[model samples]
Target chain A: MSKIKVENLTKVFGKQKKRALQLLKEGQTKKDILEKTGCTVGVNQANFTVEEGEIFVIMGLSGSGKSTLVRMLNRLIDPTSGSVFIDSEDISKVNDDQLRQIRRKTISMVFQRFALFPHRTVLENTAYGLEVQGIPKNKREDRAMETLQMVGLKGYEHQLPSQLSGGMQQRVGLARALTNDPDILLMDEAFSALDPLIRKDMQDELIELQSAMQKTIVFITHDLDEALRIGDRIALMKDGVIVQIGTPEEILTDPANEYVERFVEDVDWSKVLQAENVMKRAEMITLDKDGPRVALNRMRETGLSSLFAVDRRNRLQGVLSADAAKQAIDEGKPLADLIERDIVKVRPDTLLNDIMVQMAETNHPVAVVSDDDRVRGVIVRGSVIGALTGKEVKTHD
Target chain B: MTESIPKLPLADVVEVIVSWLQANVGWLFDFISNLIEPTVAFFTAVLMFLPTLVTIVLIAALTWWLSSWRIALFTLIGLMLIANLGYWEESAQTTALVLTATVISIIIGVPIGILCGKNDTARNIITPILDFMQTMPAFVYLVPAVIFFSLGTVPGVIASVVFSMPPTIRLTNLGIRQVPEDLIEASDAFGSTSSQKLFKIQLPLAKTTIMAGINQTIMLALSMVVIASMIGARGLGEAVLTAVQRIEVGTGFEAGLAIVIIAIVLDRLTQNLGQGNGQHPRN
Candidate 1:
């Protein structure tokens, strides 16, 4: 089931909220509504869902309402209209006490500024959410210590936040949120304050932690690259409305509008598009069923110098060149002897940029494999050049 | 021909209000005075009971604890000078009065300040009143204090508390209001109740500003010692008043020097205390 479902969530800020809502319903632009009613539209008709264990990113430029939308999920900013369902429960309708309970038990948030209490020690800050839940002091500390270790902050418990570096402080922030073991994590530009190197480290750490913990995370960022790197699905917002929501590849290759296309224009596609995006289905011979004669025939038919030899289950055995196949067929040798196992193999998710270097080192095409060693497709130099130069290569299944 | 502007009956208006309060809420005034009288008496008695040398030693030790030994040495020498001049007892009485007024002011001011900080209506109502309290001449409050408590140390303390409370309340409110918006949001996001946020986040982060407020209140209360003496309150102010009545320049100079000595000691001690609290290492 989807962990969070937000439907038609809208927030209007200022005195004439009802008028603003009316203007919004009347289909006036945010600027027009602001001029007409003197109220700013913070968020407008945002709708999206975060599936279980997915890293769903909400991204936009400053003043695009990405932060406002995230806040509305937890009801930190009460919506003028619409509802947010968490685990099928509409959090927008919960009373203050139930809201508090939900915030304590269901969702925890990390802030842009690493809003750790400057007065509290690292341990105290990390254990803050658990403390709010009234966990016993000893148990809370134990859980907090475990989380701290998970976030790579094992020895700095007694130190104050001021004493830690910016990266360390954010780790403490992450540790604080994780200490509660909540079902969903709402991270609002949590790494935006750190330097680039540190931000990258934190992003990598978050991805690692997400893999291990498998918690549904709704991450907010203004950085497109960060969204592409970490998000399972990304929602691009503009002017208080979500413009498009799709996977990183879909958002890059099939942007819904000119705005989205312009937003992604500067992105380095080679880093985003993977081997699966550029790989083509390869002609292959079954090693158990087909001999060297079949391999040679398939290579000639496909007009390829070499063909992959695979088992009956399509697990890659080796590559067989036409010369080796011909020698094997004349000598009456098994196809295994003719097969070459020295060719490079890569996973389907390997980035095109990474594959570029591997392709440069060898003169042969690279085979893309699934986790169970099944050959899915093969990436040739032409396909890599085609994808990098904006030619659409048929993506692998 | 000249046009005469109508005379404003501000003093008459004040006199009427004072009389009405005295008639209707006189028991409230009595109850407050009754409550504060023993605390004042207790502090005064303790100061009077301690020997001059012992009191000097204790104050010097407090100075040493709060600041450096250099300030403590100055305190020791200064107190000895007052003792030698035969003004030690008056200085003790003044210290007692200032301490009593400062304590009472903080107790009343801090909560009001916190309330003002949290609520817009309370802030709006209290801000103008605070402005009037701070800008009014210190002697004006003594009249109402004398009328309500009627000629004693209690009246002096009440007047001093009235004069000194505005800074504490104003600074406390400002301190809490100045707490970063992100921190408040973080606390709220974590599901902290209002009281928990106040105590844990707002109060702790506002400590330095509140300490500054306390320091200002202490200074203002000390400034009221001479004015408070007019209501028959005993202290070095009384000694100065007596010397002025007799026009004895030498006596006045000696009493005046003792008051100065007492002021320096109290100022240094309180300033050090505030600074000490402000500089508490992160924990």
Candidate 2:
């Protein structure tokens, strides 16, 4: 089910909203509209749908209107024109009472500045959503306590938000949002205020939490790396308009425009390009059929240091190094006898950053295998270096 | 040289308006006086009915409860000094008058402040009116107040309210408006109604500032006591007024000293009301 669907949603701040909307519809740029109508386009003609249990990231630079766009999702700022549908109800058209009811039951937001009530203790801040809903005190606190513990804030329940570090404060913010158990969670720069190391931990924690809870999330951020790390799909925005939306691999490998291309140019490829993206088609000898002679001949022809050994089903068995294969042929041994069964293997989805660690742990090449144990690709040290230095990694057959 | 603007007849215009209000709303004014007089009188009577030593101990105990023992000690010493100076009744009356004005100011001011804080248009409309109220000379309010309530503590109270209310209203508005924008947004995003947001979020965060405003109102009301005495209001102001007429320096100084002691005690009491609520995060 589509938990949220925004259609032609627009917000123009200031008095001349109608004029600004008209100018925007006529294709005037945000700056041009601001000059002509004295109105700034906050979010210009946004349209997207969030499916159930997906983390949809809205990534952009400052003033790109991503923050404004996420605020529109929960009707925090009323749309000057357009519709926001949450769980198929047109929230933009809902009356104040109806909108509030939807906000209470269907959506909650986490803020950039860790907007935990400074006066409220951690437990009180976490329980605020339920408190607004008028849930009984004992019941709400019980639920809030569970969420606080879930966010790793078990012992700090009575401490105020200002007493915590920025990262800890945001955990309370996230716990506050989750206590309502809303289907859609809107996180507006929730991790942007934290330092880089803490932000990475938070991003990892959010991804971990999302898998267990399966809430549809609309995450807004200026950090492309953070977006790519947690987002199931990313919508790149510019100047109040969404330029493109795609998966992490699609965005990194196939940018839709020069703006997106430049925006993603500085992203660390080792984090984004996965094993499948950076790997080459693996060459292996069939352990049940191929002899040591075949493995040695193939290694010599390809100028490769090692070859993978696989069963007849093409399932990975082990690896055969040039030294082992040559020693096997000299000693008149079978291919299986020379196959090193203890070589490290990774799934095709493993990140290059992880593969780099695995590569450093051993002398053997990393084999990318499928879930069912078929050898899909291989990551050589040369290939890993090429991928780290190159902007685009070309997967060779 | 003759004035080019024809002198504006502003004084005559104001007098005519006051006369018209007195004619039409004479009963309304009487009703308001009836309401205010009894409340002020009841509190004054209770304070007067108590033995001087008993009242001082009671007030000192109250200060001890509301604030630290240090302020309680100061209040105890100050009240005893006022009693020792033979101005006990006058001190009691002034305390009663100031407390009544402070209560009325808060009751009438906080709602108007909330309105101005939440609505920009309301704020713009009220801001200039507040400026006029504050900038007008303090004694000028006596004319219409005497016309409406006809002289006594009622008119005195009416004038003091007009004088002291602006600070309460202005500070309340500022406190509410100064609450962090992100907190307001957080409340809104959580489905809080305007009232819910006001009570649960804005007001709590603004409590310290609003308390400061109330403290200002009390101090201003106390300052207005001597000025309010020009009408028939009784208190230390009347004692001071009587001394001025007789040229008795010792008597005037004693009454004046009593007022100063009372002001300090009230100031300390109200000033301590905002403390130790866990308002700020512990370091």
Candidate 3:
């Protein structure tokens, strides 16, 4: 369900005419000439897939190629080398008319400047995109009215853009983009120009709209918090490369490299990562309610050996040691009685780093999982260590 | 005498210029006469199509509708007096000639203003030429115009348009550029083509300033009647010029009053239009 795929994208601006002339006289290869007077790559061989109905964010600082990358997706600025596919159809080879057709039908872009026509009334500005696609005036106006209402700008349609405040003007811009019913909406810092209070309001509005519409959105923002808040998955970009792309929790706790780690390190992890992310899946373990003798035998028999003691309700109790179980059997006690239920556990959704810190401070080998006093799984010290050192370890059930 | 020289006060310099102008007042009378001659002839020529009485009433009614009723009432009174004062027909013709010339000047002026407003190259080319036209005296504008198009209402119109057209062009350019950048960008992002951007954003936003420019142009054109009449153009300017030559102060005052009335009516109409809706400053 990849909605758009961009591959081997590159953008180079301006040829060195003087250098070319000098090189021609010296009979140097074009490669040598290019090497000597190199073109600045705005986007260097970028590759990514935008999934269907997902909010994909491209995050970067100024001049980090994220803006250029987004622009290339819609062919706002053509790439020097590469292809962009919308639903697996190559759009780069399309003629101008076809390109505009694609833009009119499939993609709509909202600019940082909120580019609404000033002379036209707000209604006219909203109806403009439909008008461009040759929708008749009365019908187009009806469409515009619907869109204006959708963006919460219904009554002031006759007023010029100059008559409204900046935030209201941006709302008009949003209405203009949505009027066409484009499949993929590309917002290039669309809210960055507004005041912080208005920016937050617009963000909430976008999220609310997204919930109902579920249109595939490719949002570009420099603010990490905005990316984390709005993005289903964020691609952290730096110096023309995607350093990492992941869910907010993965990016925060297990950043792919130093650049991404620095960006995520300062984030309030407890608030950003949800319970669903850190929750251990229940399929990893089997229930065993038999006494200490059978539990110890099961632990010794299993390879990469460990035993998770659980009750009939499938709630995690604690890990039972083979030696402790043997002594428990010698004392003639039940397995649940011998099993340590005082075990500290993290919820599945807790941040991996937060769990590591908790385990370090408690000096425990394992932490039990619980859902309303019912144990789910044990987060062992080995799992925490493996996550930290980028090691993949088999989960103990 | 050289060693003990004293400087004159600033008030003395102002007095010098004022006294010099007053002393040469007779020359001013002759200059006004030379400007009104052709305006009278043009009025006489257009009179065959419509009677003087009908023209006067129509013009008075137009003034009333376009401007305030008070100005219209005053204009009607002035026309009735001009008709009775033996200089009525001549004054009517002069009025027709001046109005025609002013309309034509506006027709040509606004588009040039729009062009300069929209393009840097056009502005750069036209700006210096307008500078010379504005800086040069009224009589200076008449020289080449008369040489090329003979002495008549046409040459008078040409000279008047030259002298009055610069403010319109310059103001229109200023107004267009003064439109907020965000509005212009908004137009662009909405996929408005270049032509749509201009008519929709640039022109509408610049409307007040453009109207203000046109207002100034009209005022300048009205001021040109006396000067244009000197080059054989007719109107109230001719009556004023002839009266002054005969030392008929009452006659001159009557014609001058008529000119002032017409100017007031036209000025108020343009001023009202410029200051109407869409002028609310961005809060």
Candidate 4:
């Protein structure tokens, strides 16, 4: 089962909820429904499932219901209709006590404004969730200390939140959520309030933390770039409805609608598109099986100066240049002797921006390798430049 | 003959209501008075029992602890002046009365303020009542105080509480309402119960504002001392009243000066306490 499954979740903020829901069922726009019923649609028919340990991002412009949708996941904002199933239990149907248990034991949240209690010490703020759980003081503090240390706030425990800088205060907020050790983290615009540099640092920190902790995070943001950088799957919200849900590559390459297209149009493609998206199938030869003559023929046919030489298992051995191939064929040497091992190799997930750098520093195309060192594909310098310039590059299985 | 304009009988309406309350709910007033009497008496007796020199020294030390030495020195010199002028005992009695009234007002005001703060309907209902309590003349409360508790320190304490309580209520409500929405959400997001949120997050963050409210309450109670004296409550107010009745300029000046000195000391101490620092200046 998915870690969280939300189906037809909706929220209407005002008294005329019945009318609003009717209009919603009739497929009225948010503005038309508001004009007709005087009830604002906060979220409309939001349906998605968050996989375990996935960083699922909900992104939108302000008032697009992204924040409202996340709040519904934890039942902080009750849904007007439909349900959210966490671990196969519909949280919308849970009682107050059960909801609180869900919040305490299953889900914890980091807020946009770094909502640390100003009167509380850093340690006390970090321990707030554990304290709410009725844990003993010493035990809670010990756990809070460890969480604080994990967030890189070791020696600053006794200081009040007001005494700390904005970034440090946000770390305390993060530590507060982490101390609960919950399965799902609902971060509502968690880094939007920080300085640009600090925001980037915090995003990096969250990514690093997620890799280590493997917590399912449903992060909310209005920033497409942030979503692209950190999200495993992104749900793009617009006008109280989720317009699209896809991976960053899919969102960038094939938007679900015009709104999604325009939303992603301004994103730097070099950063968003990885080697997997830009790579083309390159003609290659197995070093153990293919002779230099075969390598030369393949290179000539592909109209390339070199070909990647791999083992029978497709593990990359090295590159075979046209000169080396011809020299090997004349000297009757093995293809292994002619192979050059100095070429750059990248993983499929390595960003095109980094691949561009590699392309700039080398004359040969970079080889895309799998974790097992098998050659997946090759990214030519032309492909990197073409992808950045918005030309479609052929991708293969 | 020109048509005469009809007069509105607001005063008669109030008089009838007061009479009805006096007749029907007199026992309730007696019960409240019974509760308040001992508290006022105990505080009064303690303040009067402490030797004037000891009281002065202790107050000066407390002021020094809570605020700057300048204010402390000011308090020391001010208390000595009152003692030299032979009004120290009366000043102490007035201080006791203000303390009693402030404590009672806080007891009545804070929870009501919290209710108003938490619920919009409660706030809408209580706001007009608070306006009435605040805007009504101080002397108007005395008429009901006398009818309920009769002429003495108890009636004076009751009147002072009624007059001074509004600021505490209004400000406490404002303070709690002013607690940032995000912080309240954070508390809720952490699964805090309603009472836990109030105590742990709301109250602590609202401390400065609530303390400001208490400071206003005490100051308002102090302002009521002389007015309360007309209903037979004793203190520096009595001395001032006596001076006024006898037309003694020297006595009135001394008593007035003593009241001013007490007001300054109370104001500085409470203001400093409201700032949430009793030890030293904030960096």
Candidate 5:
């Protein structure tokens, strides 16, 4: 089972819930339903399942019900209809005691506002979750201190939340949620309130933390760029509904609808889309096994200018141009003999925008290699611009 | 206008409730009176037992500890000046009365404030009663207080409690309500029990507002006790009443000045209790 499965989950705000829901079922828009029944539909049939140990981001502009959707997972706002299954247990149907246990032992939420208690010192606020569990003060403080240190707030434990900067206060908020040692972490736009540079740093830190902790995190954000930066998979929301759910690359390259398209349109593509996202499958002639005849034949048949030369293990060695292949064929030499070591190489995770500069001086396909020297894919200069501008590019002749 | 509304029996209804309470719940009133009368008297007795200089010096020291040296110096000079005017003992009795009434009000008020803060229905029910308690004339409470507890310091203490408690309740409720909604959500999101949320979050956050209210309560109690002297209560109020009754302007001026001195000291001390928390205010 998935870590979290929200099935046809919905929430309505106001006294006329039943009428509003009926209006919703009759296919009325959120505005239409609100106008008719005076009840706002906060979440409308939002459905998705998050796998274990993935950052599943729910993203939309304000009032899109992304916040409401996350709240219903923990029953912070009771669902007007449907079920939220965490580990195959229906959390939406749990008793108060059961829900409390789940909240304490299973899921912990970090909020957008940092929500650090102004009256409490960093240590006390961090230890609050454990304190509520009736743990002894010394033990809880020790645990709290450890989490605080993990969040890079070791020495400031005694200071109040108000004394800390916005970033430091959010670190305290993170430490508070982490002090409980929960399995599933819910981050409701946890970094959105920080300054841009600080937000990027926080996003990087969260990504690093996630790799080590491997907790399933449901992150919420209004910024599509933020969603693409850290999310393994994103659920794009619009008007109280999930418009699409896909990986960052898929969402950007092929949005599900006009709403998702608009959300991804102005996104800083350089910051999110990697080399692997835009790279084509690399065509290579085996370095030792294939000779100049084979290289020439393959290049001619594929109508390509050049091809990567790799070993039997598929480790990239060098490139062979069509001219160089002809040179080798005339000289009666092997593929390895004519291999050009001047070919540009990039890591698979390198940003596509970075590859454009790398592609400038080389006629050969830019090789995307792994850290282990494996050939992953190839990118052409024209394709880089094509990916950046969201269009198809003609191969460089 | 003559007979359209038939002259709603509001006054008579209130009179019947008071008489019924006096007739049927007289023993409960006596029990409360017995409980409260000696507490106020004991505080006064403690004040009277100390030498004038010792009490003044102790108060000055307390004021210094609670606030700044400037306020303490003022307190020192003011009490000395009052003593020089021959109202030291009466001022001590008045201070004791204000302290006793404030303690009772805080004890009764804070929990009700928390209840009102958490429960909408409780707040809705109690808000109108608070309005009635606050806006009703101060003299109106004295009549019921005298009818319930009869005369002397008991009725005076009870009347002062009625007159002085609304600010504490109102401010505490407002303070709790004013805590950022996200903070409350943060608490609830952590699965805190209601009591944990109150003690760990609400009360600490509400402390300054509550302290301000308590300061207001002390001032109201001080003023009400002076008014309470008409019902046979003791202290500087009695002295002032006596002076005013005989039209002794000089004596009345001295007593009134002493009351003002005490009010300043009490106000300064309580106000600093809230301000000294050293927390930078946050949203």
Candidate 6:
């Protein structure tokens, strides 16, 4: 079930009469005036359903409204229009007092700036949301301590926000957002402000936290790589509109438009796209009784240089490269004896990014697919490349 | 022999310093006043050129615009009514006196503010004095003015100036101190001179806070107008005092309402002018 849902949200600023008067007085051109007074359409027709325990990421550049969209989920900023449902209840129209109750108990947010009250110590800042919910001070402190320990900030709870490094401050922000035991956590570029090394550490820390307590998270960032690293599903935003939403592998392999393609263009596909996407289906290829020669020729026809040499029932076959087969045939060796065994393999479920890494490291062009040592199919560099570049692949979903 | 030779008492050294200060006091005050007098005189003259009726209406309209139009309309109506009710001349006199006093206070107070902002020692030394100046009753300041300058507009001006000056100085110092360190560093990196840094960056950043202080100073000066009338300064304060003495309820009420109108107007105009230039002055 979806934990949070947002639909068609919008926000426009400077609607007051004085602002209108000022605009008229300034003698601004219609275009400039319109730009200044225009409706931001902050979350234009935004619609999303985040499942329970999902780490859904909203990725966008600055001013693309990802932060604004996340802020609406917790009612930090009211939407100009649209509805938000948290746990099946519409919270868009909730009054300030009721919203406060919802925020205190149902959803918590960590700001990119780590908006920990500068005057407060780490422990106090973490405990604030709980205190607002009327939790006893001592109990809240204890809970805050537990959260601090969870975020690896156990030794530094007494320090001020200014006293901590950027990473530590963000951990404090994370701890504070989580201390209330809310069902949903909204992180608005929570680690983007930190140093690169520190950002990675915080991402790993968040993964560890989510593994133990799988509250739904809507994290926002401008970094596509970070989104892919952390997100269970990602919503890519452009100009206040959601361009696409899906798993990292889906986005990497099947971008919706040229905009998304431009974003992913410089990405190292060998490290990002997985081998499972390119893995051939065993039933799709015909097995020849003529053995390896026939299979190699069929691979060349299929634009693959290698084939999986299988038995009559299609079980326990090894890879047959055309070059290897030809060399063995010329050397007067039996085709079955010459066929190389112990080829690299991939499960259909392995992420494309992981498979690409393995392929690059091992310099393997073709990987064998098997079901318990029974040959499934041969996945070659060309097939995977086509899949990575968003070409249509004839494969089962 | 060294132990037997006792040091001269500290009082002897203090006495000599006091004598020297007394001799130089007139020269010091003259030189400082000469340095400040032209700026103060310039604004004061410009302010006086504004016709009394226009000043009242302009100030009221400005205050209303910055705060709320509703408040502005009420203030404008109030000022006109106060004039029609025969308190117009007195209200004008009070407006003139308060504006003059506030302007003078800013001139003198801003320099002290700069000093306090630039020097840690000055800030530390002057902070307690500022606290005392802010907290002490406006009436207490009159006691010193009465003893030194005697009674009337001049003495009342002196007393009102002391009461109103602290906020400007304190706020200016605070505003300067609050300027972002990164911005200051960037200025330095660009090879900006001290004066350039002060004028271009620090002062501009502190403008909002300084304006707020000026607003507070004006309000304080307005409040003192009625009290200063007890010593013989004329205006709305005198009208209110006379009405009170003679038990003229209508007169007193009109005069009191006039002060409120004037307060609203002055408050708004300063606020708008300070906040208007398309930059949010960080308070």
Task: Write down the C-alpha DockQ for each prediction.
Answer: 0.71, 0.74, 0.23, 0.63, 0.64, 0.02
| Candidate 2 residue B91 C-alpha distance from true site, Å | 0.6
What's the lDDT for all of these models? 0.89, 0.89, 0.73, 0.90, 0.88, 0.74
TM-scores of the candidates are: 0.95, 0.96, 0.67, 0.95, 0.94, 0.54
**Tens digit of lDDT per residue, candidate 3, span A205-272?**
99999998889999999988889888999998886667788876577667899888788756654446
For model 5, the stretches where C-alpha displacement exceeds 4 angstroms are: A281-306, A312-314, A321-338, A347-349, A360-364, A370-376, A393-397, B1-15, B278-283
User: What DockQ does model 2 achieve?
Assistant: 0.74
For residues B150-210, write the lDDT of model 1, one tens digit per residue. Answer: 9988999999999999999999999999999988988888888888889889998887788
Q: How far out, in Å, is residue B16 in model 1?
A: 2.5
Positional deviation of residue A178's Cα in model 1 after best superposition, in angstroms: 1.7
Q: How many angstroms is residue A98 displaced in model 1 relative to the true structure, after the best TM-score fit?
A: 1.6
What are the per-candidate TM-scores when only chain A is compared? 0.93, 0.95, 0.69, 0.94, 0.90, 0.78
DockQ (C-alpha) of model 3?
0.23
Per-residue C-alpha lDDT of model 6 across residues A1-397, encoded as one tens digit per residue: 6888776665434464344335534644334544766623455668899999999999988878787788778666677667899988888887656776777677877777776655457897788776655679899999999999988899898877788989888888888888878888888888989999989888888998899999999999999889988999999998777899988877876789988888877765545544455676542222346644565667667866666666667664566667876876578666677666665667655666666666776543445454565654556556777876667444346
Instruction: Place model 2 in a CAPRI quality band.
Output: medium
In model 1 chain A, where is the ten-residue run with the lowest total lDDT? A388-397
As a whole number from 0 to 100, the lDDT of residue B207 in candidate 4 is: 75
Listed per model in order, the count of residue pairs whose N, CA or C atoms clash below 3 Å is 0, 0, 34, 0, 0, 5
lDDT of 5: 0.88
Residue lDDT tens for model 2, A1-397:
6888899999999998888988999999999998998899989999998899999999999999998899888888888999998888898888999888888988999999988888888999999989989999999999999999999999999987778999999999999999999999999999999999999999999999998999999999999999899999999999999999988878877899999999988989999888987888788899888887888899888988789999989999899988888888789888788778998899888888988998999988888999999999888888888888854486433
> Which of candidates 3 and 5 is the stronger one according to lDDT?
5
Task: Order candidates by DockQ, high to low.
Answer: 2, 1, 5, 4, 3, 6
Regions of model 1 farther than 4 Å from truth: A287-300, A326-335, A395-397, B1-8, B281-283
